[model samples]
Target: MIHEISAVAFRQNLGEMLNQVQYRHDSILIKKDGKPVAALIDARLFERIRRMPARFDALCHRIETAYAAVPEAEGLAEIDAAVAETRAGR
Candidate 1:
């Protein structure tokens, strides 16, 4: 379960919160004025998401290269057609 705490409380217990996140894999949601402002999560999960953008950009570049000969509008239409066909089967 996630633990929710105010920003002021979190600042006072920074070390303890870090330990809980590192050792127990607990997520702490930090709030300011009752609105969620940040989160303390396991390092492993953070690293995975941190690296995703680069990998995603590379994949998009490859797809764009493969579809280079097709006009932008036509390529989008083709993609829409493919998605519609796949969804129709389900």
Candidate 2:
């Protein structure tokens, strides 16, 4: 679950919010001056994110290989069609 609270409210209930993060794994977005300033998340999730290396390069390599195997314009048209279908909620 995602929860949002003001910085002042979060400070006032810091202990309870920590418990919620630790036990319930709920993410918290803390806003200050009517804008998002910080987030509170479970430590385990943070560690997992820290441990993972970004895979954008691998994804780009796969896309390049796929495009190379097909007519580039056709592949791009297919991709555009798929994106349009997705955006149209099909």
List CA RMSD, all candidates: 2.4, 2.9
lDDT of 1 by residue, 22-64 (tens): 9999999999999999999999989999999999999999988
Model 1 residue 50 CA deviation (Å) reads: 2.2
Error (Å) of candidate 2 at residue 83 is 4.1
Cα error, candidate 1, residue 16 (Å):
2.9
**Candidate 1 stretches greater than 4 Å from native:** 83-90
lDDT per prediction?
0.95, 0.91
RMSD of 1: 2.4
Residues 30-79 of candidate 2: C-alpha lDDT, one tens digit per residue:
99998999999999999887766556667888889867878878888999
Give the C-alpha miss distance for residue 13 in model 1, angstroms: 2.9
